[model samples]
Target: MYVPPAFKDDEVESIRATICSAGVANLVTATADGPIATPLPLFLDETEGEHGVLYGHLAKANPQWRSAPTGEALAIFMGPEAYVTPSWYATKQETGKVVPTWNYITVHAYGPVEFFQEPERLLEVVTRLTNIHEKSRAKPWAVSDAPAGFIASLLRGIIGVRIPVTRFEGKRKMSQNRPEADRIGVAAGLAACEKPQDREMASLIPIPA
Candidate 1:
């Protein structure tokens, strides 16, 4: 959350891309007892409000839904990330002043939280969520694939969540603060690594003009 000016990501499309690509988020809420969080697969509804709405579900047994929230809820979405060794910085060879750092993208959405149990709404939320994730499959599955009674029974064990996001905090730390040579070294180093994520991160590093 302590995003420096160089790392701040305020671009609307960039923020939305990070959220959508994250696929899952950590939903957190402050309560009288304490803070509670749940890792949830959430989707953004850009049509809903000024900042858009977030939708997800939680198991009925999860106490996070039962506790009364004291303030706005926070949903954290994380994107590509990789460790950057000082060895990848040209400054390490030139002046030996560079230290290790991390490159990553993240978004934090905050808004009022609402929990609902209506079977119809629950069904709709789950169906839409399922379709979003399954659409890429060779044979995409649908809620209609299952028997009505079976689907209804399963829906009873979960509760729906909705958050009309009031604000968003996005950060993209991709070696933007480093010198051009150091950044190039980082990109090359990461691109050559075996981890696919590191290679993915390599492409996100900004190339100096």
Candidate 2:
């Protein structure tokens, strides 16, 4: 990520929070057949390593798992994003100098990825992943809710992925480069947007006191 000093976000805890909050993420790997990527929901185990550990799974039939990754893999977590128009900048009236840009948060995590098909570990991964998503439902579901034989058979068709994070880089581009007046204008414009995501981004802007 090409983050300028004004846009950089080096806060480790903040970065971890962003990744955990992302509903879905892209897991990417470099392979002999170019690059392969998978979109999946992942959970973090923070106690495992200096950075942390990530857990997820993909269909056993997915070629991404079959393909051998040459080195470390990358997981991209994207957060709230909003467009900032030049018209939203107060400076546009004075010098017509403002340009459009985007404000958002992102995290790139790198680590060695290990793929496994062990029934025991896969069952654990599936159950935990199920619980994470089902926790918010009116009627939450559980891995054990399904027939034991059926669930076991289903688990056989997939593989678990563990990436022990070696490093994490985060970026929060929230209009820090803009002057105070311009930033305030942009915030006001985004705050008025109908989309919750835009309003969310607007709230992230650091307003000068």
- Which candidate wins on lDDT? 1
Candidate 1 lDDT tens digits, 1-209: 89999999999999999998987899999999999999999999999989999999999999999999999999999999999999998899889997898899999999999999999999999998999899999999999999999999999999999999999999999999899999999999999999999999999999865
Q: Which parts of model 2 have CA positions greater than 4 angstroms off?
A: none
lDDT by candidate, in order shown: 0.95, 0.91
Which structure among the candidates has the greatest TM-score? 1
lDDT of 1 at 146: 95
Alpha-carbon deviation at 56 in model 1, angstroms: 0.5
lDDT for model 2: 0.91
> What is the per-residue lDDT of model 2 for residues 3-37, given as tens digits with 9 covering 90 to 100?
78887778988998898789999999999989999
RMSD values for the candidates in order, in angstroms, are 0.9, 1.2
Worst 10 residues of 2 by lDDT: 1-10
Q: Which whole-number lDDT from 0 to 100 does residue 85 have in model 2? A: 91
TM-score of 2: 0.96
Model 2 Cα RMSD, Å? 1.2
